[model samples]
Target chain A: MKTILSVENLIKKYKNFKAVDDLSFDVKKGEILGLLGPNGSGKSTTINCILSLLKFESGKITIFGCEMRPDAYDIKKDIGVVFQEVAVFEELNVIDNIDYFCGLYIKDKEYRKKCIDDAIKLVGLEDFKKFYPKQLSGGLLRRLNIACGIAHKPKLVFLDEPTVAVDPQSRNNILDGIKKLRDNGATIIYTTHYMEEVEILCDRVIIIDKGKIIASGTGDELKELSKIEEKVTVEIDSLDEKILEEIKQFKNVDEATYNNGILFITYKKGKNNLSSLIDYLKKVDVHYDKIYSERPTLNDVFLYLTGKELRD
Target chain B: MFLHNLKYSLKTLFKNKMLIFWTYAFPLILGTFFYLAFSNIENSEKLDIIDIAIVDNEEFNNSIALKESFRNLSGENEQEQLFNIKYVDLAEAKTLLENDEIAGYLLVEDSPKVIVKTSGINETILKYVTEEIIQNEDVLTNIIEEKLNSTVIDGSIEEFIQNVREDAISMLDTSSLQIRDITSKKLSYTMIEFYTLIAMTALYGGIIGMTAINQNLANMSNNGKRIAVSPTNRIKIIFSSLLSSFIVQIIGLFILFMYTVFALKVDYGNNFPMIILLSLTGSLAGLSLGLAVGTIFKINENLKTGIIIAFTMLGSFLSGMMGITMKYIIDTNAPIVNKLNPVNMITDGFYSLYYYTTYNRFYFNIISLLIFSLIMIILSVLALRRQKYDSI
Candidate 1:
């Protein structure tokens, strides 16, 4: 796949604080790349730099092999951006807003109508074509914002928390629309704090902290890089110190903590470790209530790498 | 793209109906009020007759001689009832004079004297009446000279003759006539001035408080940013805005002009087309002024309104809309500012229609408005060139 967008050593500073520092990434064509970071982690700065909305002190950004400048009109025409904050003309209705943004590129009225109709249908805002931004619900407004940005059928699109502060139904619709965009031969750069969204939508993910990319791989590959191997949870009516000691002696066990009648254990990397632990528990004559083990999730991988909770 | 921008501008304007009402409708209503007040003053002044009271205290059995003398003395034609003249007793006259029921009272005595409670006596009536009495004195003098020649032992009438001559001479000069006429004629632009003033008030009122539209433009996908990024020349956008402003100004000017012509019945002179042309040109100045102001001040609606008012009042004052020759010093030295003032150009344009039978000054005024408009448009475009959406 061809590289749709490439940024090298992007740096943005305000007075003394560096908003984006030494950030480099490449988004290939026809792939969904998730940009995952915590609050104040330079996510917005990086997106702004890519859009040429903010100036960078040191960086090389090439969109479709053209240098980005104030007059890079052609490049801008091919690129679509949905900001984290919902930005649409409040004066215009959903249909007109979509048409306006689409008309920026496709000037032909006939073609613009087709594109607008498609965009409206894609975002499930067909019922709200005549509604102004003020008249629409929050979730519906979010859908209108996404429809405006992607209406031009851009080769590469940037969705910056497009589903942020939306209801579950609207979030689901936006996720579905984003997946359809990727499937229709368009590359997408998605950013969000929702780990589940990234796991469900992104083909690959890049986790950044303190203005540097700490990890970059597919979801499963990044999960493998996490220090956690497996999570084992044992539910019991009550737990004695002797049973805790026996569970601690199991091989491949990393750490164990008991709280509120549930024993949580983290094990080292090993296959059949859960079966071995269960067999050992049976041989030790400990009455087991229930046992369960599962692989680390993307949330676990995020917490392990960023050392911070996802929702914080 | 032009349509789209205008559509959104109008939409935002509509969505905020209260804003549009204040910007467009409110000024129109206020303008109409001012128009009525000023037109009423003009109409009333023309139809009003000055009330005069004559307190006849002299018990003259030979009043015919006095009346006949007045007819032949003054050569200037006199209307029989120039002053709404009424004869009354001294007490009644004094009471009416004090109460302002009568304009003034003339007490005829050995020496005729007048008493006025107010200083603002009508000059035209005063001149006509004084001339009539002077003629009466001339006839009285001729009769006295005849009587003296025919009779004997009439002691020197020198003191009486001297007083009579002095009174006649005093009444002939009537110096106040020139000053009073000039003031009244100069004030003739009341209706025209009011119309232009309201047009300007409406324009500035709208332009100044148009915060809602400005804010919407600022928040949008950056019409400024997009123009900057696009291959489409930035000059086109500026031109488009100027063109749109020109359109709006024309509509405002039309409303004001129509109101003056049809509703107020103001005489715009034989060169009616020229007056419209001048008004249109002046509106360009208004538009440019609005653009320059909008560009310089980047904030919310309240600040925009305040700045608009400041500029409007400054322009109106310097244009001499508030008073005549108050800005004469500025008008002479800084002709550009005065000429560029939309209020001044509009008022002066109408004045040219009234005073000049030839189109010489009218042409000059039109050219002045045009040049002023051109300069403002150029400066506005320059100011607009640097316009960008700054984050607030």
Candidate 2:
């Protein structure tokens, strides 16, 4: 696949603190690239550098085979950015706001009108064409913000935590609209802290922490990197600490814990770990209601790679 | 692209009711208050009549012409009267003068003289009256001698004397001597308050300029961040936004000007076109000042607004917006400050148009305003040239 965006050795500093430190990544054409990180992990700073909206101490960035600079209008014309903070004019109504932003790129009156209408429909803001920003609810306002950014139908789009404070329904609609944009041949760089969103939408995921990329791969590939092979959860009526300790001694069992009449077990490269646990439970005469085993998920991989430290 | 930006900018700025109130309504309201407070002062000055005393001795009784002239001067024609005369003995006249019951006392004889404790407007009038009486008596005596010597046989001496007395009374009529010189084109001192009000209105354009800068700079607002990332050139954005703000401010100024001129009857000179042009330039200066301050200061919006208000008010205060004497005080103490202050330049421009027959001062003020505006705009553009921000 052709590379749409490439960053090499990006370094952004604020006095004594480094916001984006030697970051390097690339996004291919016609694919959704997920940048997953906690707050202040430099996801926004890195995106800003790529768009040339921020100056870096030392770095190189290329978009569509051309060096990215502040005045690179040709490259910028095909790029769209939806900021984490909604940035629509409060004085303008929904339709006018979208049309004004769309006019920034598409100057043709008729064509710009069509693009604006399409964006409005895509964001499900058709009923709010004449509503000012202050008159709209938070969810509607978020949708309007997204429509304003993408109304020009640019070939490349950047969505920076677009669903940060949106309701579930609006979040779902925004995600679906983003997918439609991708399917319509627009390359997307999606940044978020939610792993589920990355799993659902991203083609490739890059997990970052402390201004550095900790891991980058497909979902299954990232899961494979984790030491946990499976997680077995068993619900029981009663369990003893001695049996839990014995379960921990199993050859494939990595860790076991019992709480509130439920037994949780993690395995390391084990086959049929659930059956083995059930046999042990029967032998121990521990009555259980139910048991299930699941493969290691992307969340586990993210935790394993970035650690379980609390981040703000 | 410029037209598009301009169109949207106009729409956005007009919708801000608070901006509209400050730029247009506040000035009109304040102007009305100034009108109410000052309209009566000029009228009161016009109606005042000076009081004087005359000694009623044998000489005063002998001068029937002076007594008749005094009666005619103190007639029922209120607009014609220059003095209210009181007849008394020499001792009583001196007592009245000493007690401040009258401005001065007249000692009547062949040559009348005025005696007063102090000199003032009333005392000056008394002196002028006394001199005029003496001069008229000399002229009448000369005319009588010339008629008797020439043997002009038209009428009797009594009839001739009566004709001369009537002519002398008509010539000495104090009614024609205007107390306040209303015919001269000196502007009312109260008009200074109105001029300063207009100056303040023009400077309110700064708020709109500040808003434009806030909407364009990346660190100022979320809207600024979005626009900063767009493909549009930053200069285009700044130019279009500033132009739109100027247009809005000019419209507000025109409304205030019309209200003051027609509704409140405030004189802003007869050169309508030049007045409008000066207002436009003044608005430009105010707007540029705001843009420069907004770009240079990395503070919050409310704090920036406060700074703009404080700065504009200081300029107005120095220019004598609060009182007419303040401008005179500043001009006497520190004339250079008036030349440097933008608000003073604006008010002075209007003042020159009204009071001066030549455009020298007016053009000087306009040029100073233009130069100040250009410097501010250049500084703002330089400050806003950075496309990338250290933080947003």
Candidate 3:
């Protein structure tokens, strides 16, 4: 796929601290690229620098095969940014807010009107076309914020933590609306700290820490970087240390530990780890109500690579 | 894009209840309070004819000029009467003074002497009239002595005396007492409150302009961030927003002007066109000052508003909004302070319209306000021209 946006050796700084340090990445055409990081991890700064909203000390930002600058109007018109914070006018109703923002990029009144209607429908704000922002709930307001940002139907969109602080249902709705945008042949750059959101939406993921990309690939490919293959958990009232040692001696068993009336046995590789644990517990007359095995997740991969959880 | 931004900026400003309260409702409320506080001044200034007594003594009869001055002051023309005089004997004059039925009693001896019960405006007026009559009496006596000494004595002496008396009274009458000047007039002293209120209204545009500029600055508001990243030129957006603010400011000022004119009956004099021009220019100065504060402060909206209010009230205080003496003191000691202050410029403009026949002072104020506005605009544009921020 053709690359739609690229940043090379980007460096943004405050008075003395670097906010985005030597960052380099490329977003493919017509794909949802997840930019994930923890709090204070340069996610917002990187996006701001890419949009030319911040003064970067040194960098080359190319959009549509041209160098991006502060005065790059041609590049800016095709881009839409839904900031992490809601940015809709409290004075304007749903439809007017969308129309005002969309008009900046699409001047034709007829086309702008259609775009406004399409944005309202896309964000499921059809019932709130005339309601002011202050009258809307937090989730509905978030949807309106998204509509204002993407009403002009730009070719490239940046959604920065768009579903933050929203209900589960609203989150699902937002995720669905974003997928629809992707299906309409528009590229999206999504930023969030939620690992599950990234795993669900991103065609490719870039995980950063300390202003640097630490990992990038498909979710499964990244998960493969984790050292542990699978883990078997058993819910039991009590367990002896000698029994933990015995579980550790099983085939390909890495370690076993018991805490809070539960037993956990980690494995690097073993197809029958759960079955073997079940058989041993049955023979030993150890009472266990539930036993299950799970594969390593993206968070586990992040922890293995960065010595911390994705949220930490 | 500029028009789109402008249209929404108008809607945004109108819908902002807080901005409306500060810029429109609050100033009107202040003006109403000012009117109520000053409503009694005109009534207190309208004076009734001061009742005075003249002692009917032989010396009073001999003093022809003093007697004639009393008759003229107590004349039958009720509208312009300065006094209502009673000719009575000494005993009757003493009774009137004791009964407090008169401001004072005048007795003519060597020169006219005034005796009063208490010191007040009416008593002061009686004393002032007696003193002026005595002065004219002395001048008449001096003229007759000079004529007798410098001319040949003949039967024409009586005729010459009559000529001197007529000439002296005529000159005194021409330059007579200004007692009637104390009545209610257009440029009353208390009207300074209204003039400064108008000036305050003009400077309240600063608050409107400040709020409007807040919507276009990235660090100030989240909407500003959205605007910053938009394809529209930043300068165009600033212009549209400021223009919208100016319109809103003028609407607020017009409401105050109308309320003062019809409801409170403030006489702004016969310079309506000049007043309007000064108001427009003053409001632009206010708006530009607010824009400058908004762009330069880099603080939150509330703090910036506080700063504008602090300076605006300071300007108004120096311009006689609180007390006219303050403006007098500043004009005497530190004229440059008010010379550069937009509030003072606006107020002086109104004062010129009320008091001066020439438009020199009014024109000077209008030009000063325009220059102040230009400086503020240049400063604000300097701060606003940057397309990118170091931190947001």
Residue range B4-72, candidate 1, lDDT tens digits: 555554454456554455445655675567666665765677534557676665542134333332322
Query: Can you write out model 3's per-residue Cα lDDT over B310-347, one digit (the tens) per residue?
Result: 89888888987776666765775688999988889999
Over A1-312, each residue of candidate 2 has an lDDT whose tens digit, in order, gives 999999999999988789898999989999999998888999999998888778889989999999998889899889998999999888899988998888778889999999999999899998999999999988889999999999999899999999888889999999999999999999999999888789899999988888888889888888889899999899988878788788889988888888887788889886977877778878878877888888887778877876763233
Q: Judge the docking of candidate 3 as incorrect, acceptable, medium or high.
A: medium
Q: Would you estimate the TM-scores of all the predictions?
A: 0.69, 0.80, 0.81
Residue-level lDDT for B392 in candidate 2: 68
Better of 1 and 3 by DockQ: 3
- Local accuracy of candidate 1 as per-residue lDDT tens digits, A1-312: 788889998887776787777888888889999998777777867876776666678989988877776457788777777877777767678887787667657768898898899889889998998899999999999999889888888888888888888999999999999999888888899988788899999999988776678888999899898877899988766777887887788777888888987889988785788888778767866666888988887778878887877667
Which pairs clash inside model 2?
A: none
lDDT of 3 by residue, A1-312 (tens): 899999999998887888788999999999999998888889999998888878889989999888887778898899999999999888899988998888878889998998888888889999889999989999999999999999999999999999999988889989999999999989999999998999999999998888888989999888878888998888999887888888889998887888898888878885888887788988988998888888887788888889988888
Interface RMSD (Å), every candidate = 4.2, 1.0, 1.0
| TM-score quality measure for candidate 2 | 0.80
Candidates by TM-score, descending order: 3, 2, 1
lDDT of 3: 0.84
* Highest-scoring model, TM-score: 3
Q: Model 2, B108-195: lDDT tens per residue?
A: 7666768888865457556645554554456556755776555446546666656765654553454321112111134255777888
Q: Mark the regions of model 1 whose C-alpha exceeds 4 Å error after superposition.
A: A230-302, A310-312, B1-19, B35-193, B196-198, B205-234, B264-270, B293-298, B313-392
